[model samples]
Target: MTGALQADLPIYDVRRPVLRLRPAKAWRHFQNLMKDKENTEEVFHIFESLPWRNLRPSAERFLRSARGQALRMREPNLPAILDDHAALRQMPAGSLAHAYCDFMEREGLTAQGLVEEFDRFAKHHVQFQDQFRWYLNRMRDVHDMLHVLTGYGRDALGESCVLAFTYSQQPSPAHLFIGYMAGLNIRRQVRSDAPVLKAVTEGKRLGKACPRLCEQSITELLPLPLEEVRRKLNITPAMHYREAHRTWAEMGVDPYDLLGKKLQKAA
Candidate 1:
């Protein structure tokens, strides 16, 4: 019998799964700690205090510096940031809130779910400016994703902790230190052990892992599926895949399946 093999058949399912959790008592403990009355009060106080409210210009300056470094390294492009802003603009005013509700319902998060609650607040309160809205949106989206990638939970304590870790790894010490201080304040409110300090110190010792994860996990895993979604959703800039691939590679990452080939070639 003459057999026809479908040469283009997919060999592996490449869909990026939604965030998954590895059961850790530590996570539960952290959650419980955040719910204590004193902790909750402190967190609420910090939110209302607006210590950094007047620091918008400073924040913008820091972000611009970070963006400059990222661009110099060619690890990220402005187009993706622009696209993210466009997506946000296209979304209904409450679309993110609705999405958070749906995500929470589907994921079985309770009303007390810290991350879900924060998402609700972020979606509602985050403002958009005509010029820098795109960058801000990109930062907001990636901040959540970073939490997922770094195994940070969504509670006030968890986010504060991860922000410290992020600060340690970012190229700018000033940015990191500022965030670290904020995290310290939150940690004090939560009455949590100064874990953020440890995270930052450890991050400095271990180096940033996200760039590598982006190369090995996100780049290799997301491209085909993201492309499929783009096609199905009629998204533009099909070149985004190529741009992301090149950007990561330029940042000393090897996103190609060639493994050590690029390293050897570089040498």
Candidate 2:
């Protein structure tokens, strides 16, 4: 807690990371998540239930990467900078910071918002290697930023696409499962020909070719032009994603409210 002396205390002998999966728990959470998309806690629970992240193989791969090495050398307090809306607004008009701030303000969200959501899940209580814990938090924190960078919205489909993209960038089985499953679930509910799965597939393809944002310096990235940042990072246009939205719009449906209506009808 902030009330106590805060420090990144390292374990003298870090425990070797292990791999595990809890599909039943994740499925249970997913069921709850489906009833109400706003249940962000269930999302985290799903992630925790499939806790392969930062585990043995993944940990080894990360430690080998330049970004991971850099993070251990200096685990920056990224959320602090990201949460500073006033300072973000002070950035150049076209900078990523400005865009991020604008998105958060318009959506009535904050960096701390996701943080709080993650902490609500039981996994947050689990002890992790201090550095690895930061890596996880950094992954969690940049999620909304990914939405901004990828042009994905907070809609149900958009969330799946972002997670698909995230799976590509981070190679998390949990992310892959949630992303694809969520997309498929949407497809099952809707009667339209929106190529929902294809849009999510495109997200994975785009993610593969883009730079890993978690490894980048937040302060360095924030000042760069938004479009320029995308270009520099090799983030491509999400054509299929836009196409899905267009399809939904032409069909006289609000994709954001699509699932809710479908659920109500079923009820």
Candidate 3:
């Protein structure tokens, strides 16, 4: 699979910014954190260190396209609002903010928890071209919103699905690496690849149907009805993750515990 993905490596011009990604290092961290999800800070470092400049070029192209220019012009004042997750949680139901909050709470996550994680990573080291900064910041802040919009949970399989969606939309090796590697681990534990494969396929399908989410003005979308937001973004409901979760529950197999036990057996 890795060989096939490598065969499809994108060839950009020499002038494009190089992200200097270290896949082996990132993969090692990915394996370690599977057994200990609490080490989310390490996962952040893995992603941060492997910056994929896919967004920078994609945004530039989108800005010049006819439909994209309109999107850029109408781009709402969103930075301040996107950074305020607590306030967003208090927003009315059916709104993007409300949906985001509900997804976080349902998944046993907190915005502040993720924010502190980012701060811990950023405080020590963060660097990028001025051109990529805006897009990168928006991507980092709106991650949970993607989970809500895509109807994916924060569980192991859910995260893989989201990463699959990201890879489809963004064309990043970082996302592909994480998604593929995690999917492999999950398949190994479950001894069945069907669930993970289905979730990833659904994610890729959704990504293709939707526009570039990173460029969307969250301020404009946040207050709109959730169904309307989905319509505008061309997003559809995802069911594979929910079904997979149910199967796992019925089998009494905790995904995380299974992962840890598998790692112990392997060691």
Candidate 4:
């Protein structure tokens, strides 16, 4: 919100693009992803190919303003920092870096894996300015970090919830469409739509309450405890997703996996 904090922010402003994007292709890919629910490649394709022509102009002022440049300067060398566990471990216990390291270890994930995936995608698919690509790459890199910060798991429901939160924060139409479609799929298969709806609604609420994370300096935030980071960002708990995970676990079922099963059958 503050122009001073936003100047150097590398967050994409959805302004006019020099590239000719294919919205239809993006839409089709999105539909396929919704049906399969496992084709992560399609997810990248959708975002990469989708025409943001109608969406970027609105955010252009903030994205290109002098303030945004300042924010960008404060942006962290995330790939470098996250790649070294020793560096991450040196941070405070409750810091974002600490939480990220813990999450990666607990989930058997690696920062390198995320980086490799994005690099591979960029090498073949993304063709844009270095600055634009930097912005996109940063978004791709921080995505899972956001999931951790927002208290969303890597489950089907969690993905929807995160997307919902994203739309609220950036109001990107592509994110909204993905969230909406995912919610619909879960609603049709699951006996109860309450959890699905609640996740989305709560995400929207959290997005509204929080500052634009895209403008924040990740390097500065990583050394602070998770609670402190959340406080600074105005991020509240994602109660709906948490409760749903608990309920489904208590029922002796992995709700996330079940959603995928139902989707496969429908497909």
Question: Which residues of candidate 3, in runs, are more than 4 Å off?
Answer: 1-17, 48-50, 61-80, 83-92, 106-112, 126-131, 192-194, 254-267
Q: Estimate each model's TM-score.
A: 0.31, 0.86, 0.74, 0.78
| TM-score, predicted candidate 1 vs. hidden true structure | 0.31
Alpha-carbon error at 195 in model 3, in Å? Answer: 1.8
Tens-digit lDDT track of model 2 for 1-267: 221112444422157345468899888889898787888998877876787554544645675577666655554566777888888888899899988988998999988887877776645365544555666677788999999999999888899999989887787677878888888888888888898999999999989988777777777788999998899889999999899999999987888877566768889
Q: Please, what is the whole-model Cα lDDT of each candidate in the order they appear?
A: 0.36, 0.79, 0.68, 0.70
Mark the regions of model 4 whose C-alpha exceeds 4 Å error after superposition. 1-24, 49-67, 70-76, 122-126, 259-267
The better candidate by TM-score, 3 or 4, is 4
- Which is better, 2 or 3, measured by TM-score? 2
Candidate 4 TM-score, true structure as reference? 0.78
- Among all windows of ten consecutive residues in candidate 1, which has the lowest summed lDDT? 1-10
Top candidate when judged by TM-score against the true structure: 2
lDDT of 1 at 29: 34
Predicted model with the maximum lDDT: 2
Locate the minimum summed-lDDT window of 10 residues in model 3.
Answer: 1-10
Deviation in Å, model 2, residue 264 alpha carbon: 9.2
For candidate 4, lDDT tens digit of each residue in 79-130? 6656678988998777898888887788787756776765666675544333
Q: Whose lDDT is higher: candidate 1's or candidate 3's?
A: 3
Order by lDDT, highest first:
2, 4, 3, 1
In model 2, where do residues sit more than 4 Å from their true spots?
1-8, 11-19, 53-75, 259-267
